[model samples]
Every structure is written in C-alpha cells, then in structure tokens.
Target: MLMPIAALLLTYLVTLALAGLAAFVLRRPLWVLLSELCGTEERSSFWTVWSMVMMIALPLLFVSWARVETDPTELLQGTVAATLTGILMAMGGMGLAVWLRVPRADSL
Candidate 1:
C-alpha cells in the first residue's frame, strides 16, 4: 500500500515538473497565437496557463483512476494526491509565466 502510494506521488510530481516546464517554454507563443486568433488587443495569460494545466491534469486523472484498484480507500487516496499535484503544478507554472513576463499581444 505504501509503495503504491509512493509511486503514485512520484508519478504526479514528475509529471507536474515536466508539464510546468513545457508550459513555461510555450506560454509566450501560445499567448500570441491565441490573442491573434481572437483578435484581442488585451494581453492575458489565462489561456496558456490554465489550458496547459487542464491538458495534462485531465488525462492524468483519468489514467490514474483507471490504473487504481477498485478499493474505495485507494481511490480516495489517489484522487487526493492527483489533486494536490495539479494544484502545485499550476501554481509553479503561473509563477514562471509571471516571472518571465508575458508580452502584450500587439507588441509581438
């Protein structure tokens, strides 16, 4: 039980790191593209940040759920772990985006 939980925690952490890095690297370009597509002069990091988080979070949750045993306790624990992991990843990603400074849509 402990070993499986540990593995699950490690899996989520590693996934968070990778996903956050990817979001950091791509945020600018994605923002530019989205702004253009929407024809908006305003600059908002909402799309890039949340979209990336959801993109990874949803699939991860599904996969983790499918992989877990039918035991109620195990399912509850896995759900909690995945939720916490996602929250951490999103915060990290948002911090990165802000630290780097997303440019104005028209500036690029």
Candidate 2:
C-alpha cells in the first residue's frame, strides 16, 4: 500500500517538474490567451497562474486514475513524449473549460 502511494507521489513530483518546464517554455502563449479571456488585469494574472497549475496537475491526475500498478520504469519510459502529450492534454482541457465558461458570440 505504501509502495503504491510512494510511486504515485514520485510520478506526481516528476510530472510537476516537467509541466513547470513546459509552462515556462510556453508562458507567453498562455499569458496572451488568459489575457484575452479575463476582463480585468487582476483576473488575467489569476487565470495565468491557475492555468499553469492545471497543466501541471492534469497529467498526474490522469496517470493516477489509470494506473493499476505503480511501476516507475513504465512511467519513466518515453517520458519526453509523455510530458509533451501531457501538456497538450492540459491545454486542451483549458480550452474546453474556457469555451464552456465564455459567453457565446451569438448570445451578444
């Protein structure tokens, strides 16, 4: 039981690092997108930070839910691809959330 939790924790930390790096690389794009969506400067900053956190959390959430066994080797194999895929998945989620929350042009 402890080992499973430990493995998950390790996966979470490593993925967080990867996600942080990805966010750092893509910060400008994220900032622009968040700024467009937010009505105020304060909210833009809030959303910018929140989106980065979401990007980091998403992969860990998926892996935790899907894994039946916590094998670190399996997790680390092809880590680069996994990290990129994770970033994309997180960005997709951010898009979906914003789309759902935003007012439609048709409504205005």
Candidate 3:
C-alpha cells in the first residue's frame, strides 16, 4: 500500500522533470510565438527556471512511485496523481515567472 503511493509520487516527479526539460528547450519558440501574437515586448524567463526545478522534482517523484508494485488499481491512482501534480507545478512555474518580472526579448 505505502509502496504504491510512493511509486506514484516518484512517477509524478519524473514526469515533471521531463516536461520541464521539454519546456526549456521549447521556451524560445514559445516566447516568440506569444510575443508575435500579443504584439507585446514581454519576456518569459520562467521557462528556464521552471525547467530546472522540474528536472529535479520529476525524477524524485518517479523513483518514489516505482517503489510500489504494478497493480491495475494502484497504477490508475498513480497516473491521476502524477498528472495533476505536473499541471500544478507547471502553472506554479508560470506564476513565478510573471511575479519575477523577467525581461522579454524580441525574437525577430
């Protein structure tokens, strides 16, 4: 029981880290698109910081999750928890970026 829960948490953490890396790599493109669409000289430094945080957080989550046995019921619960945690972490990273007033650069 406890092992399953731990596994779920670990998976969630790993997913978060992977997602953050993806975001970091795509940050430049994302910022360019947003700037062009919005026609604002705003910058988004949140991607890099968030990516770093996720890189650390996700692996931990996954390792913890993997400690449990692979049962159907446990798997389902773990998936849901991991998904929600990732989403929340992403949002929080965005929020932090906004709060920090990171400078926006023109990608053109």
Candidate 4:
C-alpha cells in the first residue's frame, strides 16, 4: 500500500542525503589523490570524472560489505533497489557539481 511506498521513498531520500554528504566531504581529498595518480597539477575533466566515480563506488563498496541480519523480503528488495537508485542519483548530482567546478578553456 501507500505505507510501503512511503518507506521506500524515505529510504531513498536518506540514502541520497547520506551519500551526497559523504561525497561533498570527500571531494577535495579524492580530487587531490586522483590528480596525483594522474600526474597532473592542472584541472582536467579526467580528474573530475574519476573523482565522481569514486565517490559513488566507495559508498557502494561499503554497502556491499555490510551484512543483513534479517531474511529477504519483498520490502527488503524494494529498499535495496531504492537505495541503489538514490546512490546513482547522488552520483549524477556530484558529476554535475564537479563539471561546474572544473574550469573551461573558453572561460580562461
């Protein structure tokens, strides 16, 4: 019913918020590491893309490591789907943010 939908919506919102917050906090460090790995000091699309990708991947890795104590149910499946969707959405938003942050040649 509506209750189940509401629960799923809540789960999605919570997941999106937490993942986005984590991405926001870790963006700078991630960019630095990526820039070093790529051996580039200047801003480039490559670093921003990889940083956003890692922002999504790292959280997913953590989630994959977590063990669920309860048995699988339809609701649980729905929740899982919602969570994944939210994570992807958050990553998409992060991609947009980073794209904006990166300097363009035309702007320089």
Candidate 5:
C-alpha cells in the first residue's frame, strides 16, 4: 500500500543523506582518483564530493528497495534495479564533476 511506498521514499532520502555525509568525508580521495583517471590537472572539489556521496548512497538505496518489497522475488529484482540505478547515478555524478569546472579548495 501507500505505507510501503512511503517507507521506500524515506529510505531513499535517508540513504541520500548518508551518501552526502560520506562524500564529504571521502571527497579528497575521490578527487585524487578522478584526477588520475581523467589525466587532468584540474580539480573540481564540489563534483568529487558529490560523486562520492552518490557512490556511498547507492548500496543503501538498494537495501531500502529490498526492504520495501513484500515478495522475495520482487525484493531481489528491486535490489538489482536499485543497484544499477545507484551505479548509473554515481557515474553520472562523477562525469558531471569531471565536465564541470568547479574550483577545488584546500581540504581541512
């Protein structure tokens, strides 16, 4: 019913928030990785943080999707779908970070 839907949305939001926190913590490492991968000297701190956040949030989103399902089959499907969605989102975020010219600031 609506309860399951609400629960799923809530879980997604919670996961997103957690990812944001993770991104904040792992921004530097993410930036370094991205910089090396792209073979660019330019640094986009904001994008790195955002991408890392998305990556961290992805697994939580899959867990939430699985939790909201009633049937085991549906849950499995949801988990797979959620995982793919998370991967796409993370990749998109990383691509955006690399394409955007956001300035990098010194980390504390």
Candidate 6:
C-alpha cells in the first residue's frame, strides 16, 4: 500500500510537470486561437498559457479519480456502467477544460 501510494504520487507529480512544460512549449497555437477568439490586437500570453495548463490538468485529475479511485475503480473492475460513466466524465472534463480556456465575453 505504501509503495503504490508513493509510486502514484511520484508519477502524478512527474507527469504534471511534464504536461505543464509541454503546455508552455505548445502555447503559441493556443495564443493564436485565443487572440482570434477575443479579437485582440495583441496576443495574451498569460491567459494563453493559463488556459493550456488548465486544459491539460482537468483530464489528468479525472484519470486519477477512477481507481486508487473506486468510482473509476469500477471501470477498472470491468463494470459496464463504470466504463460508460468514466467515458462520460472524461468527455465532460475535456469540454470543461476547453470552455474554461475560453475567456468569457466580460473577460474580453
């Protein structure tokens, strides 16, 4: 139990750092897209990177929630219901990440 917990923790932290690095490097496309969406004369690098990180983080959290996470454990346990719910949650998280990445009208 202790070993697995340590390993999971290590894995989560390492992967999160990698994901953040990847998001930072790939920030240009998001900057372009967001700039277009906001109709801004200049790209907002702060918001762009922030959105990218959030987009990556959301799904990662959902994945960690399932096993070691029992709600997701059922899916791992091969239950059909769990599988459907897991897929739905993943999609919802993805959508939310994208939604959150988008600045609201008021923000613009």
Runs of candidate 5 with Cα error greater than 4 angstroms are: 1-33, 36-50, 62-67, 102-108
RMSD of each: 10.1, 4.6, 7.9, 10.3, 8.9, 7.8
How do all the candidates rank in terms of lDDT, highest first?
2, 5, 1, 4, 3, 6
Return the lDDT, model 2, position 70.
52
lDDT of 3 by residue, 4-100 (tens): 5665565555455555665567567656544554455543344444454664565445435544546657665655565556556655765675445
Q: Give stretches of model 4 more than 4 Å off.
A: 41-48, 57-108
Candidate 5 residue lDDT tens string, 1-108: 345666566556655665555556667777786776556655445556556656877667566546676454564466556765676677676668555644457532
TM-score of each: 0.49, 0.62, 0.40, 0.44, 0.43, 0.46
Candidates, ranked, TM-score: 2, 1, 6, 4, 5, 3
Cα lDDT tens digits for candidate 4, 1-108: 336446545544545566667667767776675575456766544766666566566545544454432333654565455456646665676567656766789998
lDDT of 2 by residue, 61-81 (tens): 665555534565675653445
Clash pairs, candidate 2, are: none
**Candidate 5 whole-model C-alpha lDDT, 0 to 1:** 0.61
Candidate 1, 26: how far from true, in Å? 1.6
Off by over 4 Å in 2: 1-6, 37-39, 68-72, 78-85, 96-108
Best by lDDT: 2
State how far residue 107 of model 4 sits from its true place (Å): 41
TM-score of model number 4: 0.44
Evaluate residue 72 in candidate 5 and report its C-alpha lDDT on the 0 to 100 scale.
44
